[model samples]
Target: MRNYSGVGNTLTLTAPYDVASGGGALIGATFGVSKLALKAGQRGPFEVTGAYDLPKDNAAVAEGVRAYWDNANKVVTATANGNTPVGVFTAARSAGAATANVRLNGSF
Candidate 1:
């Protein structure tokens, strides 16, 4: 499109806190996964426009269902109350499964 910004899928921003590659990074009010290891005060790119396989809570997550972020456990869950939704679960996750593929679509 003529108005397309031509920006790639990832965005570069200063890390507000230490973040490991593939780990969640919450910048200002935006949440995304760090594409590279970044220390506090460093600048790096993060993948914010794609799905990511992230850790999930101990509850089973049905395929195509929405999932929320459990800040306390640093994992995603199907629960809606008191937790911020992160994305839709792309696949079913049995209880106690280590992780779930989530199509990230959340904000701070």
Candidate 2:
């Protein structure tokens, strides 16, 4: 255990842009939920793992399907094209819904 570190569920990252608490942020290639509001260039904790209610596009999503992070739009999506894989949809989401439930996979 000499090289052990703390659990990585929450990690520190400099915000690339102003982000509110519970907002999704992508730093470099890592994506996670901000633990607190952070101004651009401020370093703070981000929860990289766990289920979350994330904003989504006007697209219906079926339960149990993989979810992707639409970084350009800052929303969770079912489309994989040009999007980063964040996790899976935990529940069905109808088109036009404001958000979708997702379980973070903790890795890009």
Candidate 3:
């Protein structure tokens, strides 16, 4: 295949802010999990397609529900009003839980 690049399982994204490894990042419309801790403005590997446990608000979330990235709070959220759609919750989580399992949709 001409002009083909390697599989885009991971992308190098510049941290918009300090982000810990496994944390979600949304750059414009692209969202992915950091492969390692990164300081603001640093560029690093971000896994774009995979299941990850990410921090979320204290709200009950059902499996198969779409997950949005709250860039302001840096958490996975069910709210879509002012957030970036990142992926889907692969596991239901009860209210008060600190995290939710999300499967990155890659194409989103």
Per-prediction TM-score, please?
0.78, 0.96, 0.95
TM-score attained by model 2: 0.96
Instruction: Give the clashing pairs for model 1.
Output: none
Best candidate (score: lDDT): 2
Q: What's model 2's lDDT at 22?
A: 99
lDDT of 2 by residue, 1-108 (tens): 799779999999999999999999989889989999999999999999999999999999999999998888999999999998999999998999999999999966
Candidate 1 lDDT score relative to the true structure? 0.81
Writing each residue's lDDT as its tens digit, candidate 3 over 1-108 gives: 898877999999898888898888887689989999999999999999989999999889999999999998899988889998888999899999999999998998
Q: What local distance difference test score does each model get?
A: 0.81, 0.94, 0.91
- Backbone clashes in model 2, listed as residue pairs: none
For candidate 2, give the lDDT of residue 43. Answer: 99
Between prediction 1 and prediction 2, the one with superior TM-score is 2
- Considering summed lDDT, which 10 consecutive residues are worst modelled in model 3? 20-29
* Predicted candidate 1 versus true structure: per-residue lDDT over 1-108, tens digit per residue: 788864656778888778889977667656678899999899998877679998888889899998777666667889989877667899998999999999987443
Clashes of each: 0, 0, 0
Indicate the residue-level lDDT of 1 in model 1: 75
Instruction: Assess the local accuracy of residue 80 in candidate 2 as a C-alpha lDDT between 0 and 100.
Output: 97
lDDT of 2: 0.94
